[model samples]
Structure formats: structure tokens, C-alpha cells
Target: MASSSKWTASDIPAQSGRIAIVTGANTGLGLATAKALAGHGAHVVLAVRDTEKGKRAADEITAEHPDATVTLQSLDLGSLRSVRAAAEALKAEFPRIDLLINNAGVMYPPKQTTEDGFELAFGTNHLGHFALTGLLLENLLPVPGSRVVTVSSVGHRIQAAIHFDDLQWERSYSRVGAYGQSKLANLLFTYELQRRLDAAETIAVAAHPGLSNTELMRHLHLPSAFNPLIGLVAQSPAMGALPTLRAATDPGVRGGQYYGPGGLGETRGYPKLVGSSSQSHDLDLARRLWTVSEELTGVTFPVG
Candidate 1:
């Protein structure tokens, strides 16, 4: 891998003895990430809400790389019970984990609530990953070079702020605003988690897939007049998965760092180290959000 060259899925190093668990690996960025990792010899676990789709994805990976090792583990981040069950199942299967990718998330959807009663986007995107990471910390602690990579989004730049007053949007709700809040929380969580895990070999990092053409945009409706313009700019899911792959496998990557596209406005292109919004770096806010998250999820990290 060239230091200055554009990073691609091929840039991922060998993972002959490694194990990785990727959330929402049924399709989109998660599937791309899992396939790339498995192609390099890693035993990839697709932690998906739908077992049938997950198995199909595993089969696809195996079909591409006959030597690939993959498995399916059921995980529904929106519900705490499901998160706990998935963690226990993973703990029983693997004593050590090399990578845990929080790639599963819900985008702009009609106002709704998760099974846990939290706002759909915030509950599934941030809190779900938060609880899952804390619950699975033990499996990662003993594995040197292990990483927890959370997938945020460039949409986070739009009205992204932690609404401490109404964390669940009990009073009012906006699909776009809630999505932004969730993505922003991903960065704060990564930064704060990295701080808490400073003494450990494992690290926490964040990445965004840029504007990818994936099913995540199912709820994103635009006027017919703007559809073509958006299509002309959005990149394929494989291209969008670059930043995440880099964050997960790049040897030089540090804890708390963010990765995204290097092209204009970070809309598309190869993966590179990128800067996050100033709001995303607020330490005070990160700490407070971390505390609130712990209380809401009832899952505590061993690092702290």
C-alpha cells in the first residue's frame, strides 16, 4: 500500500489469524467491508438483524473467495435484549476479537420509536452501538491491535447537536435532525471511548462512507428535478466503504481519528484521513453524552 496512493479495498492487509464482527452486514457498506476483510483471510462474522439475509451475504462472500471464512450472528441493535444476546453468543464463539465495526444504522425515516422507546435513529445508530461495544469490550481488550470502528456520515454536518434536554425527541421530532444527532453521537462516542481505552492496546475510531448509493437512502426523498443531480455525484457502495476499511485496517491509524473521502466536499473518492466538525470534537459534550448513554443503555464499559 502506497503511503500517498489512494486507499482501496485492496489496500487492506492480510487477516489470516484475525476475527472481525460487522453489524448490519447483510448489505450496503457493511457487506462491502465484510467481503473485503474476508477476502484478506479474516474470519468475518455478519451480525445482522435478519439471519436469512446474513446467510445470503456470507454465501456471496464465500462464492467470491472460496477460502473465505464467515458466519452469521443475529443482532438487533434497537433492543437491549437482542444486543445482550448477540454479545453472549459472540463471547462463546470467540475469546478474542480483532475488529468490531458499528456499521449498522437507520437513516431518515418517518418519526418512529425503537423497541426500547428511544428515537429510532438515535436509539439504533448511537445507543445500540454504544451498548454493543461496552458489552463486547472483554473480547477486544486482550487482542492487540484490535479496533472499534463506528461508521458516521457526512450528513452529520447538518443540524448535528446532542439535544440533552430532549434526548429522545419527546417534545418534537425531525427525521433529518435526529439522523444528524445520531451520526454526531458516533464521533463523540468514538473520541470518548478512545480516551477511556487509552491504557489498553485496543483503540476506537470513526469513519464515514461519504454519499454512497446504498439502501440507507431509502427514506431520502427528493424532487424529480434534483434526482439526476444527486445521482451524478453519489458513489458506489464499494467506493464509499473505503474510509471504513481504512479505519479498520490501516496500520498507522490512531485512536479517535476520523476517515472519509478525499474528493470535493468529501462526497466521493478514495479514503483518507479527514477532519470532523468542531462540534463533533467537543470534549465536554462527549463526556456528558457518554454518561447519559450509559444510563439509558444500562451497559457500562470496563475501561472507565
Candidate 2:
């Protein structure tokens, strides 16, 4: 990897002929990621919940890069049925997948459950991605240099716990705490998935944007007075997306490794290798989460 102090999107390797599927590609970090990949040479798929919005995003990519090959596929990460349907459609259309970027997420929303009755944050942020990845693993496993890049968050270190006893947050809930657990789960899932893919061609890596200004934060519901403060500190979506882009494209990135901003407190800066909370490294915890996730989603990885 290049020095963390200076790495940028220009460092991305040529992606000619690669097939990349990025979730939540309609806006924010996901949009920035899709644009970068499509601008390079990859055939990009914008997997989103809203086809109309997805079409607009695809159009935007093509407008920016006339030769960019972009397509839209409906995917609602909050629903297992939607995930399965999208995965099946993707498999039938494309046998080889070079990249799967799990970037869509919900943050700090009013307490609610997914269509499957999972806590909104945990369901959309972790379980949905988990099932989608498992269903799509076969398509990526056979392709050399393929990767699964999951987007975690710094929130994982902030009051985050598995809460296995109340994974659904059914008894009590703190929006911030619930979001933290979901982010932590993202890391647990990535690490365990990488372990399973250790002998396969595909690799699993994780990244975090570190406080970018984007639509994902709409649910924050902060006072209008704080908007300017947030704008001053938050980086652009393109800047926030560097860590993810690097994780997805950097050849030096290894399985189970994580990338994030290099700035102080990792709030905003260029991409670099970063560390996660100690709780994220518990092998036993990861295994347990993996088993429970399989039971919850009813989606199992092909790997043992």
C-alpha cells in the first residue's frame, strides 16, 4: 500500500472488465464509489431499493463518463426476500462478480423493525448485507482478485456491544447504541467472512468513511443550529469514500484488514489502514455472531 498520508483515488488499479456491485449506489458514499469504479473501467451495478432513484444514479454516472457501463438492480437490504431476489437476478445475469461493496446503511432512526421484524439499524446495516453476501459468494469465489468490501463505522467503538441476549433491541433501545451494535456487527461479519474465504480466490475486507456529509445522516435529526458545525468538520462524500474505494481496489489490501481516514480521530482525511475496537477482534465472539446470523437470516456461506 502507498503511504497513508498521500493515497488517493488515482492510486486505484485499472479495473477494466471487472464487474462491481455496490449497494445503495443511488447516493452518498455509495454513489461516489460507483462513479469512481465506473469512471475507471468496471461494469458497475447500482443495487438499490428504489429503481427510479437508481436509474437516475446510473444516468449520472454515464453523464460523467460517456463510456461507463452502468446498470440498476432492485435491492432492499431491510428485507431478506428482496436480498434473495436481487442475488438471484444478479447471478443469472452475471456469472463473475469482481466486487461487492456493502455500503448502504440506516442510522439513528426512530425505533422500528424491518419487514422481517429485526431492529431497523441491525437489520438494514448488518443482517441484510450478511445474507446478500452469502447468496452472492459463489459468484465471486471463482473469480480471481474478487473482493467483498463492507463499510463499517467509527460508531462501532462507541458504546457498541453484540447484545446477543437482546439482539433485536426488543426490551429497550438507545438509537446511538443500536447503531453502534450494527456497525460492530459489520466488522464481526467481515472478519469471519475473511476467515472462511482464506483458501478461496475471493477476499473480505472492511472500511469506514469517518464522518462524511451525506444523506445517510438525515436520521441524525440534530438541531438546525449544528448543521454548520457538521458541515465544517465533515468531509465530502468523495473524500469519505476513499477508504472504501481503496479497500475495494488496492492490491496491497489483505483479507480481514480494515481501512479508514488517516486524520486525527479518523473524522476526515485520506484513506489508510486503521484499527477497530478490541471487542471487534474477539474470535469467539465472531464465531457466535456468525452462527446466530445464519439462524436469523437462514443464509449460509458456501465455505465451511
Candidate 3:
């Protein structure tokens, strides 16, 4: 029994002839998002770091949808070299990208840096996607209804803000704070991108999967005593992926709009239009971050 009032994956419109690229599509919410789109008739390309896992994911999609068109492409978000290579491959293969879902990310992890010498969380979650989208912007510009959907999280509300002085967290770091900064960057990226794409047919949007059981939390550390309690409260990855699916497919969704769980505290439920923190909407901060991101990634967008 499906409730029309509640927007589920089934609510996604026909995606025939559409081409979607989902990052980190080898597992969890990314996999779920890829599956839904493939099921809806889109040609989905799983952009992942591990080609072996990516092939497995593509096989899984085809196993379920015999007629599905699924492909796997290598993408290591932690490295700018990989980002550029992946973008080149995608551009060579697909003339127009209908949906670019930046759904891959890292959560709380020990202090680390990407190959490009950026804080790991911010590098992969923000800068990586930033570079990818910019490099692929030319392909998306000609396609009507094309979108860039960046997946954020409720964690963005936690001690989050761009620390320009220490963008890489080189001075000091708290895993939680760094993770929140990355998530906040996701929204700021979206808002700034949308503003730049205002006159273009393409748009940029953001989404957050509430606390869902996913491998993305592998870095989370808690006392053994609390593991069971946390598991009991977490939502399924399928439900967690709804906001992303909605943000990607909803007809009424406007550029810069955000989607998330509709339940209390936005922990878990069906997807719906949601609001972000005031800090996430700070135009000055977004602009500055965008500029810094361009300089760091060496990728300039088609938009002004």
C-alpha cells in the first residue's frame, strides 16, 4: 500500500533517455539512488573509487532490472588527478548529463589529508565534487532540466562554518567539526551554484539523508554500550536516499532548494522540501568559499 501523500522512490517520474552519474554509487545511499534511477529507465553510471565494487554495483542493478543500462567509471574523489580524469571520461562518453548526483562523502574520521593536501573530509565531500561539477558544466549547459544534486547531512547543523584561515584544518582539528564543515560546504556550494546558474536552464540543489544505517558511518566511534541504541534509532538506507532522489527528480524543485527527511528532528521519514541553517545561507560566505574552491581545485565553472 503506497500513500500518495508520501513521496517515495516510486514517485520519481519516467527517466527514459536520461543519463545520470552518481558518485560513490558502489554502496549505501549512493547505491540506492542509482538503483531507483536505473529502475526508472535512466542510463546510470556509477562513479566510484573502487572499480571492483563499482562493477559489482552495476551488476546488482542489472540483476534487478534486466533491461537496465548501467555502467561503472573509476572516480577517486580524494585526488584531483582522478577527478579530472573521471570528468574527461564522462565528457567523452556522454554528450549531455541530465543529473550529476554528488552523493559520496566521508563522516567523522581521524585527522587525514587527501592526496591534494586537503583535509580528507572537506576534500572528498566538497572540493572533489566541486571540481567534478565544474569540469562537467559545459556538458550540462546544453541539456534542459540538467541538475547537480549535492548530498549534505543534518550534521551540517553541528559546529559548522568555513574556517577560511584554516581551510585545511592544518592548525588543529576535531573530526566532528571537520565533518560538519564539509557538510556545510555542500549547502554553501549548492546555494552559490544555483545563484550562478540562475539564468541557465541547469540548476543546483542539495539534499540530506537523515541518520541512516550506512557504511558512511564506519568512522563513528561510540562505546559498545551505545551501539545497539544507535542501531535501533537509525533509518534504513533506502529511506535515507529519498531526499536525494526527490531533489534529483522532483518537477517543482527550484535551484538552491534543499530536501530532507520530513520526520521530527529530520532524523527519518519521507522526503520533502526542507530549510537549511542561516549559516548555510550566508551569501558572503558562500561566495568566498566558491572562490577559494575554484582556486584550490583549478576548475572554473561555466557560470560567471
Candidate 4:
């Protein structure tokens, strides 16, 4: 892949007739990524948790580019029912999905459980997207030149590895630790999926938003008030979206590639190919996590 350190939104290639699904597209970096894809003439599906927000986001993007075909669909990554419904709907309507951006995520939140009784941050951040991706693999696998781009964070480096004994943090819960584990799972999932896809010769890649300022910090704000400091110094959502956008559209990119900013501490800058933590690239754990995720979500992928 070419050096994308100097690349900007204008460098994105035209995507006319392309179909893309972006989870959490109602706001922040996900919205920015969706807008970028639509700007290139892709049929953008804004998979959001809230229908009202999804519609509004779609309208806002279409307003900017009247010809930027956009659609709003409900997707609550915290719930398995929601993931299944969204995937089934996507399959029924769209014959192919050229790109799938697993861009939505949640940051640190006070200890709590999701609708499925798993830790909120881990459940939503990792398991939800994990199940969603597996459910939609059938449509994605056969699509010519299709790719699955997952959005991760530098927080992945914040945690060492998954705590198998207390995977749900039942013994004790540290918000930062749980968040790190989830983000790390994103990378693991990405790499694992890529390995599986490669074995099946399908496309799968991963990316990180670095330390961009986005609504993912909404939870981190109320409970701990840590977001203010991050916001004051963090990159804007558009800047954060660059890494994801680069991973999705850059022709030079390849499966299993990891992208991030080229700035100080990789916290912010233009998107470029980057490295990931060794744990994130661990094939054994990735495979274990995949099996665990399938059993938990009741979603089996045909690809593997």
C-alpha cells in the first residue's frame, strides 16, 4: 500500500453504484465515515440505534449531496435480536454489500450489563459487532471485491489481554480495563475474521480511529468526567473518521491491514497503515473469541 499519511478526504476514490453499511452512522465518526462514502456516490446505509437519529443523519448527508443515496436502518449493537433483524433485512433488500464498516462503538462506562446481561461496554463494543458481522457474512462473502472494515481504538493497547476467568468482569470490574478488552477484541475479531476470510478467500480488514473526539466519550463523561480533557486535546470527528475511511476506500489497502493516525502517539493525524499490539494479532485467542461469540450470539457464519 502507498503511504496514505498525506491523504485527505478528497483523495477518496469515486464509489458510484457501490453499497455500504455503516453501523452507528447516526453520529460522530461513523456519521463522518458514512458521509464520506456517500460523497463518493455509494448507496450508504446508516445502521443506527435510533430510527429518528438515523433518519436525521441520512437527511443531513443527502442534503449536502442530493445525489448521495442514503438509507436509514435500525441497529442496536447491544442486542442480539437487533443484530439479527438488521442483517436479515440487509440480505433481503441488497443483493450485495461492497463494504461493511463496523464503525460504531462505546467507550468506558460504569459497571453495568447489556440487554443480554453481559457487561455493557464489552457486550456492545465487541460481542454485538462480532455477532452482526457473522450474521451478514453470507451476503458479504460472495460480493465481488467486498471488504469488512472494523473500527478499533488505541484503547486496545490499554489492556493486556482478555481475562478468560472473569470474561464478564464478574469478579471485579474496572471501566478502563473492560473498555480495553473490548477494543482489543475488535482487533482480534478483525484479524481472526481476516484469517477466516483469507482461508475462504474473502476480504476483511481492521482500522483504528486513534484519539479523535467523538460521542463515544459520552459515557466516559458522565461517570468519570474524563472526556473534557480528551476533548480539549483530541482530534475532531472528521479527523477520527480518516483512518476508517482510508481502510475502506484506499485501493492499495489489503486484508488484515491496521490503520491509524501518524501524529504524536498515534493520537491524531492523517490516516495511514499502522501496526497493532501483539495480543490483537493472536490467532489462537481470536479463534477462541470467535467460537465464544458465535455460541453467545447464536449466529453461525457460513464462511468458516
Candidate 5:
């Protein structure tokens, strides 16, 4: 709770007996976040699309911390059916969940759609997590100090808008614009969810990794010329995962707060409480998006 400017994995308090579900835990920032949590004595479920990769990631975590409890749950965020199945399995297995980290996401990939026909970025990044959180929220509602930590991105400030008229981007699409929309939706979802949970023990918070060197950048398609510059400026997955770790584990974190890098432009540094774009704070927009998300995913929060 002290100045987060110096916050790191070492600052994470003991997480013994906690149950954490981290999406996309197979690699990059997700892997780092999961490993750190497990190392801190939390039982972590690596909810991923690839069982093989999840197993490997779990193995890696246990190898580093022999006492770590790591499990795998098959999840494909692009498909609503998959999300529901994963949520059901999780609910049946764990009566309580302390943390739900919506960490998995797709970046600037070529225009495509998910199994549910929503834009890949928007569907996987926003709608998928929206439904999953709603479905699993019941497990957390009764547990005091429970939290839902959503991973957003600095890109949310770039070319981002609700685009209600063309939410699917069927008429036209710009990969950057679509990605930004999804990240911005993340904040909207968190703020609105927090409002709904005002009287509950559960809380909603959001964080961004800044410019981290991770697989998410595979689709960035930045010219080879920028590789050197990017490599120099981008932080490691461990560092990038700090904001998320702080958001999820920091006792001082409050509902609706956003965390990001502490350096200039919030490009790279240690985790800190960061400000979001003005549009992301639009209460009306958040409410509207929440309604549309429920309609699209057919998953309603119990808080509502």
C-alpha cells in the first residue's frame, strides 16, 4: 500500500490459501503473473485455450516453486460456449475464488471474427471476459476481499471509441481501432462492475502492462526497423506484469481504480496508480456497454 513506485513481485504479501484464476497463463505477462501468485502460496488455475501450453506453464511454475499449486482449465475466450463450460467447471471445483485476472488478449491481428462472430479483439478481449466474470462472480460475491482484476492496455487511449453503431466493425475495420475499442471497454466494464458491486464484498479493478515484450506483440507488425528501438524501450514480462500483480494483490487497491507503469507516457516502469482517458470514465457509456455486452454474450451479472 506504500508508494507503488517501488512495488515489485517481492512486495506481494503472502497469498496462502488464495485461489487465483489467470487467463492466458501459458506465456508472457500472464505466465509471469501466475507464477508470482503461485510462488506466493496461492493455488492458481491457468485458464488457457491450449491445454498443452497450460501444462507446460504449470510445470514451469511448480519447477520453480515446488510447493506451488497450479492447475489447468481449458478456455477459449473467443467462444461463449467455451467460457461457460470453463466457468461451470471452475465453480464446481472451487466454492470460492479470490482473484479473477482477465489477462489474455489478442493485439493488432488481421481483421477476423471469433466463433461467436464478434470482432476477434473485441470478442476475445472484452465480451469473453465480460461473460466469464459474470458467470463466475457468484463464487466471489460471498468471499470477503475478493477481487476481479482486468488487464487493459495503454492502446485504449489511441483511436478508441464505443462505436455502438458498428460494434462488430462489419462495415469496415482498422486493427488498431478495434484493439483500442476492446481495451477501452475493459475499463468501462471494470468501473461499471464496481458500481454494481458497491454493497458486495467483491471489487473490480483494472491494470495495463504498458509496452511489454511479449507474444501479444507478434501481431503488432511494426517494421523491422523499429525492433531495436522497441527492444530498448519495452520492459520484460515480469516488469510488465507488476501493474497487474499490484492491482490484484495490493491491499490498498480500491474498486474502479486503474494501475499502469509509473514512467513517462506510462510506456514502461514499475506499477503505480495511473489515470485513464476521460472517455473511459463515462458512466453512461459504461452502463450502455454493460447492457449491450449482456445482450451479446447472454451472461448477466448477479449484482444486476
Candidate 6:
């Protein structure tokens, strides 16, 4: 994987007439991704938690790309009902969606349960998107060449797959461990979704923004000053967005492909084709996790 991240927004394919949905688009990586997609001519849907913040982000994008059609829709990724409603609204409003970028996520936080009662990180980051994809399957499948891009994290290396026995962390839970589990679920969902997409000839891919300065760290106890060090090493939100854009728009991208930075240790660099961990790519685990996700979310993706 060479430095594919070297490509700038100019490198993105023109996206006229395409519709896209980006979760958690009010700030951080999600906002940057939606802005870039719309900048390239896609009509972007910003699925956000805070309408006010979403408006601010949407305003900024519109100011930058006057032609950028960004719509703000309320979403609480922690709640399955909200995910369903957002997807339903999109389905009724849009004839088709060419791209769905599952980019919103929560980082480490104190032990908490979602509206659905699942662990917060796992619930918001994985199950939420999992259910959203299911709800949007009909519209997504209608468009030929459509793509679903799920974002995971390098922290996926910390956990191979979730412990099924503690899917909700009923027994015991640690913040970092839960975070790792959620990230690992992202990979499993990506791999499994890719498998199903390929089997049904649908398109699904996965990516990760190397490292970036985003509010994703707000959940961390780190001081604001440490963010500068992160910025020094991390890529800008636009830079971090390359992998996602590539996954969504690159014509040559194949199902199951994963993209990330090409720099040293994949910490920061231009986006490029990158290899996932052996565990992240495990087929057996992906299959099992898919069933678990479906059962937990009570929404099976309409892959066929």
C-alpha cells in the first residue's frame, strides 16, 4: 500500500446526482467526510445527534461548497428506534443512495448502557450502524454500483471478536475493552457485510481514518493541550477522509477491500490500500459475529 492518502479532494471522482448518508456528521471526522462528499457533488445526509451542531456544520459546508447539498437529520445512534426512523426517512425521501458511510462512533467513556441497553461504545459504533444498514437495504440495493463503507479503528487490534457470552457486558466491562470490542465488531461487520454483498453481488467495503484531531477524543480524559501533539502526528480531517472517499467513489475498489494510511505504522499518511490484522479478517469470526449482530439488533440486512 503506497501513499494513496496523498490524493487531495481534487482526486475524488465527480459525484453529481449521487446521494450519500454520513452518520455522526455534526463534528469530527463525520463532518469532514460529509463536506468532502458534497464538495465533490454528492447530496450528503448528515445523520447527527445535535441539530444545532449539525446546523452549524451544515452551514459551514454550504458556505464552503455553495453547491454542496447537505441535509441534517436527527439520529441517536444509541437508540435502535432512532436509527430506524432516520433510515426510513431517507428511504422515503431519496430514490436511491449511492453511498452509505458508517463513520460516526463513540470513544472510551465511563460504563454506560444505550437506550437499547447495550454497552454504549458497542451500541453506538456497531449495532447502530448495523441496524441502519438493514433498514436502508431496499433503497441501497436498488442502485447498481452502490457502496457501503464501514469505519473501524486501529484499536481493532486489541480485540479479535466480542465475547458472545457478554454481548451486552452484563457480567463485567472495561471502557477500553468495550471500545476494542466495538471496533472489532466494526471489522467483523465489515467483513461479513462484504461477504454477503459479494455473495449477492452487492458492494460493501471498509476503511479507517488513520489518526486525526476530532471530538472523538472528548470522551478521553486527556487534556486539550495533548491534542496538538495528536495534530502534529495525525492527519487533518480532510486527509483522514481520503480512505472513506476512496471506498465510496473509487471505481476499482472491490468488495471486502480495506483502506487506511500508508505511512509508518499506519498512524498517519496518505490513504491507501492497507492490510487488516489477521484477526480482523477472520472469516469464521465474521460469520459468527454477523449472526450475533442480527440477533441483537433484530434487523437482518436484506442482502439477497
Better of 4 and 5 by TM-score: 5
- Tally clashes: model 1: 0
Give one digit per residue, the lDDT tens place, for model 2 in 73-120: 999999999999999999999999999999999989999999999999
* Decoy 2 TM-score against native: 0.98
Clashes by residue pair, model 3: none
Candidate 6 lDDT (Cα, 0 to 1):
0.84
lDDT of 3 at 182: 98
In candidate 4, what residue range of length 10 has the lowest lDDT sum?
218-227
> What does candidate 4's lDDT look like per residue over 1-304, in tens digits?
3455687888889999889999999999999999989999899999999999999899889888888999988998888888889989998988778898998877888898888988887799889988888878887787777889998888898855788778889989888899999989999988888777765535788888777777776665444466567767799988889888888988888889999998888898898888989888788888888888888888777765
- Weakest 10 consecutive residues of candidate 6 by summed lDDT: 1-10
Regions of model 1 farther than 4 Å from truth: none
- Across 127-225, the per-residue lDDT of candidate 1 in tens digits comes to 999999999999999999999999999978898899999989999998989999999999999999999998898999999998988999889887778
- Model 6 per-residue lDDT tens digits across residues 1-304: 2235475567778898989999988887888889988898999999998999999999999999997898988999999989888888888898788888999998888899999899999999999999999888778886888888999888888644577888778888777888988988887888888777765535888888887778777777878788678768877888888888788888778988888877878777777888877887778888888888889889987773
lDDT values, one for every candidate: 0.94, 0.95, 0.94, 0.85, 0.96, 0.84
Among these predicted structures, which one has the highest lDDT?
Answer: 5
lDDT, residue 215, candidate 4: 76
Alpha-carbon shift of residue 192 in model 1 (angstroms): 0.3
Better of 1 and 6 by TM-score: 1
Q: Which ranges of candidate 3 are over 4 A from the true structure? A: 1-5
Per-residue C-alpha lDDT of model 3 across residues 106-167, encoded as one tens digit per residue: 99989999999999999999999999999999999899999999999999989898899999
TM-score for each candidate, following the candidate numbering: 0.98, 0.98, 0.98, 0.94, 0.99, 0.94
Q: In model 4, which regions exceed 4 Å deviation? A: 1-3, 199-201, 222-232
Q: Candidate 5: worst 10 consecutive residues by lDDT?
A: 1-10
The residue ranges of model 6 lying beyond 4 angstroms of the native Cα positions read: 1-5, 199-201, 223-228
